[model samples]
Target chain A: MQIARHIAEQPTTIVESYRSAARTLETYAPGPIGRVLLIGSGSSFNAGTVALPSMRAAFAGEVSVVGPQDFLRRPDTVPVRGTLAVVVSQSGASATSLEVARRAAAMGCATLVLTANAESAAAALGLPLVLMPAGDETIGPKTKGYVASVAALQAIAARFGADIADPAELAPNLEAALAAAETRAKALAPALDKVDTILVAGDGADFGTALEGSLKIAEIAGIPTAAYTIEEALHGRLHGLSERSLVLAIAADEVGRTEASTVREALAPHGIAVETVAAGPTDALPTPWCTLASTFLFQYMAVELALRRGREPDLMRYPGLTRRLAIKVDDSQ
Target chain B: MQIARHIAEQPTTIVESYRSAARTLETYAPGPIGRVLLIGSGSSFNAGTVALPSMRAAFAGEVSVVGPQDFLRRPDTVPVRGTLAVVVSQSGASATSLEVARRAAAMGCATLVLTANAESAAAALGLPLVLMPAGDETIGPKTKGYVASVAALQAIAARFGADIADPAELAPNLEAALAAAETRAKALAPALDKVDTILVAGDGADFGTALEGSLKIAEIAGIPTAAYTIEEALHGRLHGLSERSLVLAIAADEVGRTEASTVREALAPHGIAVETVAAGPTDALPTPWCTLASTFLFQYMAVELALRRGREPDLMRYPGLTRRLAIKVDDSQ
Candidate 1:
């Protein structure tokens, strides 16, 4: 109920605040960083998938994204010199992210913390912080927090040298995208209603977006779902691709469009019903009604999918489980 | 047949040479210099998993391990300063491992290239090249390459700071372990005969060992299989645990004894047939056998399993498929 009220009151403003914060980052630290590492846990980690392509395009150097769990367990894999560590967290108190931040600082790398809470431990670690304005959620499972993180990261990418042709045009496009998403969500609600398993796919920038979309459905719908890069899905996992599987493909940009099309083609032969929301053809201004718009639509679709299955779209029962088993950090050793 | 010959002729001198090289590392570098990063691919990476616990115990600072695929994908996650990058490869031609070495050199990290070929690309990069004397394999899949990589890394650990109790004592222990592994494999062959799917479980050092064991089975036996850390196995994946699932639990030293015990206990409750290969008692002498002996046993068991299922263990129709597809690096991009 608390999450529902928060969602009802500030959905548009939360999206707007993300746009504003992204503009702030562009104004502050613009241009190529030597290396970029995105680290987070669970949904926060999954959120990084959405930003992968954009981050690679924005940062001229190598971009590597991993779960904080991987980084914590394998710190030596982290570059010690001239590297930028971007720690992503919704609560911002994820034990592993904090430890990674501490380790990165000790190794003398430039660190940036992104979270909904600017005052969280990650921010307190003296790193430059990007705070999402979507406020906070007391919900046991993340819904708003997840979307807010994606929007804030999108803003960060836009601010920090994303190859967008027109920066000033982003706001209106984003607004339109959200509206388009709502309409699409309503239309797709029926198909999502009866599905027990889902498969989401994308490539490049949308790969992470597809992953987040899959996680959103899993966390909210309690349905077994998996996400894969388009190429990886085709390798061996394609055997699981079938008519009964609800395949959601996000084709957000030119890099992913061809692969997304290939995936759709491959699945069609198997009689799998494919739902594709892609960046519209290039002649028009890259409208939010296309790629960026599809993200919100998928989030809405996941909610509808949950409702279609007769599950509450917002309620989560697994509260305190995450905090209790907060990623075990071996600080003592 | 080719793989069998490669194993039979694999020089014991290679083991001796690795021991000498490890001693050289101890004499020069002694104790942990900074952070140590172990990098490898396929079987070589599997060797790192076996070496991790002892390496961590011996080194003063952090010791983390990852495969070349993971390292190349996320170099920013690796420590860039005051770090030593250990690149392990048997052939040293492995594209990913070579790239990792190049990246480490670019980052100004001290690099140690361990390989069978002294003139390998990884070695030619002018890092401290420690050569193993293991001969070439005609078979596409690894056999002796797997064991040699482990022996080489184990020697390095002993040299750097691994508490092996007595260095001179390892050779005899390794021989005994190999013989014991052969015996165990034959005894367990009956259970593995009919299994179509295999699951391997271990904790700590053996976690990586189990992964390699499973990979060998998958690559050689051509069966669907997966390996997970014992803790990860308990996290919902246990639902898939079954009698049809051939479970190989590698119970190595005290480092993993508790979790290994838990995995063994958990499986029986689910009616999953479990086989436990005791590497040693909880307080056994620290040796590769303590981690690897069980893995070696399972590799042969898996082959027998494949034989019973009417599949030829050595003839891989999928040879180079994983290398060509599963791990295609976008080097051009």
Candidate 2:
């Protein structure tokens, strides 16, 4: 599948972004930024969300992730002044995202946009634009785009003084992680195909990965899947689970592992399977690039499961329905 | 089911909270509140989230909802000093809520906690406490407590200069709304019982209603349910649908109606049932009390659907599993 190729392309994307993002940030604002508002939707949103913690640790300003509709809907709640509002749209064609950029700009905020298309409406807004080095992903569910988006945000955080690992040093690790994820996911896809529902759970950085991973599975495999922060699932969402349910836990940290094990033990009695997937190494990248590993795992699993179930992994199961909504514009990458 | 009784107790709970919440807020901070940071998890978080737009309109400063884990996990993202941090817990026993209250207080934010139990660890923090008039919800999934929590936040917004409708006036209206909701839910219960999955979608004020409603269904009905802001669902989650799927759209506002209709029309081609629930009257209450109407509908549907499916509504289908997570402390409710 082309997605497999896209998954393999993530390592180079990260390396190139580390060099380009800093130069772009410098041009946007030479002065130190205060509060950071990273905005996007779907997979784009997940990438920015996954990098939030490291971004916060890198700089003192409040780093927050906002959905395009949420930000546009709530004006009074936004901190505009001295706020660096970065709108990330991998395709640069989310209709609401362009509105967010326009609104953020009009509100006198330092609005910056990162996308693959410079000629797209969002980049045409004349805001500080950073075109991702990640090549085109012509599919509905993104694989390389997710990695590039996260790496872009991490580069921005690193520039802001976060003690991030150099992206150059992670090439071998990313390749190794991707290979391991493919093997693990291929073996697990058959079991996943038999489940009626899937719940992907994680914590901290992995929470963002879980969200993106779940979205990939839902869109690509056409499986009924949901994402949850481990704590949130524990709070209430666990009640609906049954023997037909399968849970994929992205446990990269110690706390995440504990929570994953907790869910595993709790659901085991019900004959539900909770698989803890490969958490790619977090030590050698700008942020916890382990999410990149998760990116590979979920993507591979989705493709394998879709193939086994006789579904198309590259295209959305119901494209006509999604297109009718007009969420993404014609200029979408 | 005690749940039906608890659901019936909502109107009285709303009326009582209007008096108590205001008096409590005035005592805690006689001065105007600038920025608001509402923190909680699950239903508590949903309650605060539902009130955000109204609270923002009530004052100039930012009003935002922060799930306890999200707030605590990202320390740098929080806006502390001079902010009013409202930590909500119907049971006052969310393990992370106590930590959120303590942290907010320590950070010099005007921390206020709302809970039903005066003896809760969260309430006993010696910080300003506003006990909910919600009474004892003693069950795993709350019905009346969700209504009471939303009412309390709305009262606080009213005190902050929001042009809210009097809770006294909502008494008869709420009663009428509740009766209407029960009838609607009863008829739909049989249809709902057959679905393997449910997606509760809404926008604006109804968005919060959608979330709490989904949780209620997932927890009480033992049916796997997910909630999505209509916009978010259109983004990607719409892909994971089948003939067995049911979409419950809370169309409170015009935007909500359009979105709901869109989802309905699109999904109908796939044989998925999309039911647009009643949007309670928006004119009579501060913000939109129509969500309260949705609250009743979702609660009653959850109960009736549970019974039809032979799953107990008042008790969790798997209590031992949820309790094992320790998300809620021993003193919960």
For every prediction, compared with the true complex, DockQ reads 0.08, 0.69
lDDT string for model 1 (B1-333, tens) is: 464454433335435655756665664552236678888766777788788867776666567676565566567756666788889877777666888888888887778888777656766777777777676554555667776777777777777666654334555655565566667777777765545356677766777777677767656665555565554443323333345566666665453455555655655544567777576422233565456545656656555665765765665534444343323332110
Please give the distance, in angstroms, between residue B187's alpha carbon in candidate 2 and its true position after superposition: 2.3
- Give the TM-score (vs. native) of candidate 1: 0.59
Q: Which stretches of model 1 miss by more than 4 angstroms? A: A1-41, A44-333, B1-17, B23-35, B52-83, B99-109, B118-127, B165-168, B175-204, B227-283, B287-289, B320-333
Candidate 2 wrong stretches, greater than 4 Å: A30-32, A281-286, A331-333, B30-32, B76-79, B281-286, B331-333
For candidate 2, the per-residue lDDT at B51 reads 89
Residue by residue across A14-45, what tens digits does model 2's lDDT show? 87876678677775553567788889988888
For candidate 2, give the docking quality class from DockQ: medium
- Per-residue alpha-carbon lDDT of model 2 for B78-188, expressed as tens digits? 666568888998888888998989988888888888998887787889988888888777876787777778888888888778877867777888888888888888888
Model 1's A-chain: what TM-score?
Answer: 0.81
